[model samples]
Target: MTRSARRTRRTRRMLSVAGLGTAALLTLSACGSSDSDSDSGNDSGSASSSASADQKLTGKVTVFAAASLKESFTTLGKEFEKAHPGTEVTFNFGGSDSLAAGITGGAPADVFAAASPKTMKTVTDAGDASGDPVTFVRNQLEIATLPGNPDKVASLKDLTTNSDLKVVLCDKTVPCGGAAQKALDAGKLKLTPVSYEQDVKSALTKVELKEADAAVVYKTDVKAAGDKVEGVDFPESADAINDYPIALLKDAPNTAAAKAFIDLVRSDDGQKVLTAAGFRKP
Candidate 1:
């Protein structure tokens, strides 16, 4: 072969080698791009998983509520526990005045449900509430008498006029007591009770146990007593309906769970439970 022909053959071999090297580089670049895309997708999925894990609720929520809320709050607490697998709902039910004192005194509660706005103010004034309290329900006073209404107590005045009837009233410091006094004032009547109890439930219990012929208490408490007592509605009670308020405590130990519980209490489902227990809507 001539020298020029040999050079031409060499040039062709060089061109072929360059072409192969370019193809290999392109292949590796394509593979690297695909791997980067796969890694990005995995990162996105991992972030979503982390976000979901962060939102899972777990822990205990302590609630300080009025005695009148026992039945309905207990039902709602159970529902809250069911909705959050790892959560627990605990309650301290008692007179609104006492519960307010407990919360304002740093009782380590996550929530406060009061029988009256006046009671709730004690906590709010002390800066113990996270936000402004919301009125969730209202309740009217009723005269609870022994089973079958042995005293024939038909109105608030009946308890006042029948000096021998043996009546019980809640202490004026509590919501029920304040409401009863309001009703009596509205009707311009006066009554001297055989005893002044600390809470509505205590007043109702007096009638249930036959310790008293009648007692001025909340409609809900009367309904809760079932066949243990009889309830008599009075026109004056309509003028003195107590507004119930609830709030999240400022230093709630379990904020997430506390918020969730409040949401449930204000929900339609919760309203049904309260209304069923004889509490009026707010």
Candidate 2:
């Protein structure tokens, strides 16, 4: 064989061996890297899970409450926030029925304080409440008139006699309205208000705005109004008393905080706040 041909053949053999070595090296590197990457990914996932699990109720608490509870509950929320240094509270105050609908629709809430047991029943019936509720306070309906008894609404029947007087009451779906109905029935007086509000707070607001001469709302709600409205006591109110029920929701994220808040409410300090706001103890 010629030296040139022999050299060429030897070169080809050397190149082939080099290529095979390169390929083996690459395959071995790929195999060695798989375990490290898998372990790294698993470690990252475990860290994320541990961080989430360690998160506590020191974060946030959301409360869905009735509109009538606006003034007092705001104070209570502030006190609760102060007592729990690491926690914060956000409130959603509105009509009881609307709050119930929101809860049933999956709105996040750690606590719920309804204006009436009937409203609380809706939550319980819908399975949104975490446990059985307890009646904390009883509210009675009153005639919210002008600041000085300008109309001199002597009795429940007198309200029906004045057709020109603009009066407001809550919608039938609300607890206040239901109690008002019972009261009106007890007095044998029929009244058709100019506007049917969604809650006691709205009814009181109507009178406060001077849009109505009178409105049927809770005495506590009227008391919360300050000089904006005047509350009149009537005999019918004795017959219609609304019970307010409060509870923690089943999906509460801050369950420990929620229970603590509830306990605070049932405590003497909480009762003092409610009573000061004109809510009668149960």
Best by lDDT: 1
Model 2, residue 180: distance off in Å is 0.8
Q: Taking the tens digit of each residue's C-alpha lDDT, what string does model 1 give over 1-282? A: 999999999999999999999999999999999988887867685775466447778999999999999999999999988978999999999999999988877799999999999999999999999999999999998889889987777988888788799999999999999998999999999988999998888888888888999989998998999999888999999989999999999999999889879988998999999999999998
Q: Candidate 2 at residue 196, lDDT?
A: 96
Each model's lDDT comes to 0.91, 0.87
Worst 10 residues of 2 by lDDT: 48-57
Evaluate model 2: give its lDDT.
0.87
Which segments of candidate 1 are over 4 A away from where they belong?
Answer: 1-54
All candidates: TM-score: 0.81, 0.78
Tens-place lDDT digits, model 2, residues 1-282: 999999999999999999999999999999889867777757685776466446554768888888888888888888988877788888999888889989988998999999888888888999999889988888888899988879888777878999878889899898899889999999899999898999888888888889899999998888988898888888989998888899999999989878777877887999999999998999
Best by TM-score: 1
